[model samples]
Target: MSSDTYDFIVVGGGTAGLVVASRLSEDPRQRVLVLEAGADTNSDPRIKIPASWVSLQGTDMDWGFRTEPQPLLGGRSIGVSQGKILGGSSSINAQVFVPCNPAVIDHWNSSLGNSGWDWETFSPYYAKAYTTPPVDDSLAVKLGIDGWTGHSSAHGPLPTSFPGNPSHPIRKAWADTFRANGHYQTQDPFIDGAQGSFSCLATVDPVTKERTSAATAYYHPNRARKNLHVLTNATVERIRFDGEDQKRATGVVYNYNGEHREVTCSKEVILAAGALQSPKVLELSGVGNTKFLGKHGIEPVIDLPGVGENLFDHLVNTTSFGAVDDLETLDPLILDPSVGEQAAKDFAERQTGLLTSMGVYTYAYLPIMEHISGEGQKRLKKLLQDNPPAPGDGPDQIRAQAYYKIAERGLLDPKQASGAYLSFIGPWGGPPEPGSRTLTLCVMLSQPLSRGSVHIGSKDISAAPIVDPNYLSNPLDLDLFAEHMLYIETLARSAPLTDLLKHPIIHRDPASDLTDLETARKWVQKNSNSMWHLGGSCAMLPRQMNGVVDSTLKVYGTTNLRIVDSSAIPLMSTANLQATVFAFAERAADLIKEAWSQK
Candidate 1:
């Protein structure tokens, strides 16, 4: 067996791993090797064009894993997609670029006991990762925070902006309605806070309007470097532990080209294989809970109880509409020339304008939107109205507790054995709103109390993890989701919105009983799916807390092991995970550089 050695060995040359490798190798002295268990980025179109990503699901480029039947979701197994390619999930996403709320950053910092984790310290990295483009200068007034963090108009490799047509008429109306309702329209909320309506930016080519993923930003730029070697189609089996100290991860054993190979990391081994795979790698290498390993007959090296604990994800349901005219509803505007000829032509010729827009652009927050409303509200109130209140608890409080448990473990129907609870939502808002084309009441619960696991399905690194996000395990979870739903419904069915939608309204494929509460519950059970943001598996925490890695991203038990991807996030952020993930990866690079400088 030929042994290859490097100063740093990075597993999974996706987003975070690539950033680490690129930044480390930039020193031109330290050697960095990235091992990817999937394909390179160039061949995947679903990754390049923002609109084409939907088709990429279940393909080889994606580790299409399904959950253990979720009782809350009608006993249905939800599909989870993670990129099995160089750029990772960033190569394939809706490209909605939003930042975490400052509160979220502060909470993370306080929990991790690291001052550097705060938004102020982490803000620069966001700037370093992308170049913000000029979009309707109208954003200055609409979006309050203009001068903070990476929200500046600084030019760089990654392009950021909204599509050229702010006149989309629908979006414009929606924005106007939000403003009239007193909701602040924010710009680059990551800079100020994710609390209002704002246009998100994507990492794309400034001239070409193409996505500038980790492959283009990191690998492609430095492919000529001799110190950096990337191996594709390499499925890592497990890490080779050093019995001498038991805390040293000396190298990795992997299956390459139908043969087993071992590669050594002299200084350190960083696992940027993401949240799901990282924990599985640790368990397979014998670094997890002793009891669980004993049950599986697998030896336990480190008794880290939190290896797969603290698992949570974002759940979202889509409410799409068919335009009254041939208004190109849910159509591919980037690829189809007829939709926006000038912008597409400009993108083809230059790389700017709407051609650069990620199809699903624009975001707003309904602050007043409560967790429940409409059909389910009356039903839940009636069902639990007579149920004796628990020890001084009010009706809302009692109901919340019940719904939380139901959502956390997943509701089960012993008869049909379908366990899940659904909350009712309303369509309250209507016409006169700038961007109000249709009403969509989204349900997202915060701080899920249910615990789940992720493990290696087989030796194939390309194979997806056995993921069970266990939605609606707690009864309170349902209530919180219901609160958000009802809030939106209120806006949809309110005076203005009601008047606009007075004509024939759109309805979801009904998934509930005839009663309002039953119908809402069934709808949620049948429709609730993941937003594809998976994290908290290889969580970042102090060593004593059973955390996988430290604040600096170094693994807890092993000196040579570090994690720099979304998996390292101890908790979920307020906004989408892309910008934050990219920022963290970039920050990890700086930390790595600083460490090498001291050495």
Candidate 2:
């Protein structure tokens, strides 16, 4: 086989891989090569346009993987759309840029046994990844960001700004409604963890009105560097490992242009193939559970059994209500072909109109106790106490105990947010009635107790992995999520926000009429879908705790193999995964540089 050599070989030229490769090539001496299984569609309009995010799904750019039939979700298979293009999911996500709770990052070290992974140590990297747009006084008031100060980052590769028209009334209405309910944010969520309602930033460039993704921010600008090479449509089959006792990744074997090729890396092989595929790559390289590998007639180089365990994702249920006719919403763009044509024309000429935003502006992160009834709170507490992690000493049991303890404390704390709610000014789940407008209220479980897995389905590298998120599998998850779902009705009926909506609210989906807790639970069981914020498949924890990687993100049984994507995130982020993934890649780059500087 024809072969090439480099200092570092990065698998999957997606979000994290591009960042690491770009950073490593800055030295002008280290040769770095990135292999991506999908084609480079960075210039495609569906990826660049802010409102065209939804249209990218099921296209060539999307992997279009679906979960195994979820029993709790009524035997329905939820579609998980992962990006199969240059920038990965960042190129196709809804672009809601938000942060994880500070406490969750702290838990990575204090409870999960990873040192130097706390909020203080990890927060700076968020600034290193993106530059927050300047918010003027008038715009701040309109966007409910008047009280925020010193939260904007002046220097970064990715540009973020508030999407949509500045005159949109829904923005102020959401702010005033939350303020009236005494749930307005006290501080900026980006600077410190706040549990109240506030406007969020989007990964869209204000000047260009285009989506600013990893390919646009990190790769395109640095592509001119001579030492950095990125090849799209290249699928890495497995890593080539050497060393008798200690397996060290030397390079990789990949398929390109229908031909098998080999490339040698002298320093390391970095795996950044995202949450679902990163673990598959490790397992394919003979690094997963020995018994599982034996089933496929493949020998295992490492006996580590946690390559695809502890999968985490945010499941969301959306409730849409009829909006007043006078209010402007995205419904016109969908229901009227003429309106969509005008919107496209406006975007082409002035970079304005319905095409500029995804219609998701306001967000609220709330504790379960804030919305549940007093009796419900008592039941939740009792339920938690009654089910204190299974009694055992095995690694799985110990991990479960640690996770449960943290979840229990956070669920009870008034300051910690357990659920996230957001507002969308348009129809969701189904098409709207002719000439009728709508607004969607989306509720998501921020910290779910239920865990799932993603594993190799067969020996072929082309086959999709078996992903089972086991949504609502934990009883506590259902109880807490139902309460949050019930709160949607209260939020929609609240004062200034209600003025935008019609009286006797007409739901887009009849099942979304959550009148009581029981109805809410039933709706959730039938309607909840993935937010696509997947992570923790190859978790970073101690080996005894079934951790696939260590604190430094190096594979547990390999010296030179490392993972630098959402897959290595020990916990799920509270909101969207884009911001956290960018920050993580920035930190991972520094970790790689620091490790090699010592050598």
Candidate 3:
């Protein structure tokens, strides 16, 4: 083999990319290479510290793709962040490790044509990807949480653990209120797809109390493999195809250090770029919709319409409440130098402090039916019964609604449905004054009936793609999200939680009055932002259904090319995407080896 050639080339050194690269190169015979556009995090304090997760956004570490003006959000162009660092969004995300609702996965395979993606089939991959810390009996008792495992330790690369210090006065208040309100049901997301609230874990190393990103656990440990190679600061220009049919992907052309370079693969080319960039690579490589390709002056190769369609993301609405009572948020840690220094010292010395926290220790995952008003529920059901698919959407999206019907039945009858995922943010996105206290609630409606697109607006590869998430486009989605926000308002005014906090600090003066449905609906539209769980752009299904990839994860008309990231998820999991993406890559790794071992 030549110096630049390999048996496999995996693009986008992100979470899934690293997983696939590491597993594929496990064999001494296979040569694998990874191309990443961003620099490695390299023990950067901003990235290592759990509390600094939000600070990484908009920095050089973030892809920072601003969405097209959402007409529904009063023409606001929301910033959709994709991690430009080694682990992709997993590196910058909140690090919560909740798996999707089991029924949601069942719905995917049953109705969405994704044949083998059920929970039972994928559960082992979850155990294979990461190991959790054992139940901290002391902290568990204080938090009133259980179901913790992984202390005996498994052999997975990534680590999952409760923060050495996850407790806050506000955190306890929120949990107590949820329980007091009868909303806190014991549905352990990891053990079962329990629909109600529970304590969750984070993707952080237990000993070091540092963020255990995909790069740290999956890629760095395997860096010394002779068959594996990683190329950082290299951006994939386009996939290189073989012969006139363009059926087989030979390698990729990428820009590294101001020069365009090509690496050939004897076996296959895999694209593990996250949702936003993977589809752009497809469009740039001439594998997207016919009209979109022609408009960008790129000759169409496969004309697969699903390459950049079916875009879905979780939109979050956050509100900060000010408390004048005996609340101790992280405000002083950021506003006062002495407190910040003390936190840094504690983490460095004992690996224990507020800095070790993933910001959110407790969260709720309940059926949307639990939150919606009776009138709203009837209206939502009627809207879905109407079953209106968006204009220009393909068959896979129509199928997604069918799966929703399953969940709808589960909700209406004694079955399953999509969830409204709400996580409490202690200390808020930004700190308040030195002595002021603030509590933030991140209200999210995870699965949406709304569908959107991601397409390259310019022929230039570096230009940002047109990402129209089309948030709140579906009347049902808008209505459901609004109901969830109202439910949060209810939580805000509930028993123990209400007693802890004073009042919310929304844009409106009369934040006290969120009772009116229309007023609350408008508040959600203006304040909602991407939860950063963007996916479902290049769906996996049959070709006739306008699927970009098949059940095997191979592109419809191409050979030796596969998408192994968030982009290939046919239906967006109704939870944080990091754990789901990790398991998917673990499964994809096996699929890749199976495909080639026979060859």
Per-residue lDDT tens digits for candidate 3, residues 463-579, read: 988899899887777776776776766666777767767655332234524675687788778777888788888888666567888878998888789999998997777678888
Output the worst ten-in-a-row residue range by lDDT, candidate 3: 146-155
**Residue 373 lDDT in model 1?**
37
| Number of clashes recorded per candidate | 62, 0, 2
Tens digits of per-residue lDDT, candidate 1, 124-173, equal 77778777776545654333233223456554445665543333433444
User: TM-score of the candidate numbered 3?
Assistant: 0.92
* Regions of candidate 2 where Cα sits further than 4 Å from its true position: 1-3, 369-376
By TM-score, the best candidate is 2
Off by over 4 Å in 3: 147-155, 164-188, 243-246, 369-377, 390-407, 410-417, 423-434, 503-513
lDDT of each: 0.62, 0.88, 0.77
- Candidate order by TM-score, decreasing, is 2, 3, 1
lDDT of 2 by residue, 271-325 (tens): 9999999989888988899999999887898888988999999999989999999
Candidate 2 vs. true structure, TM-score: 0.98
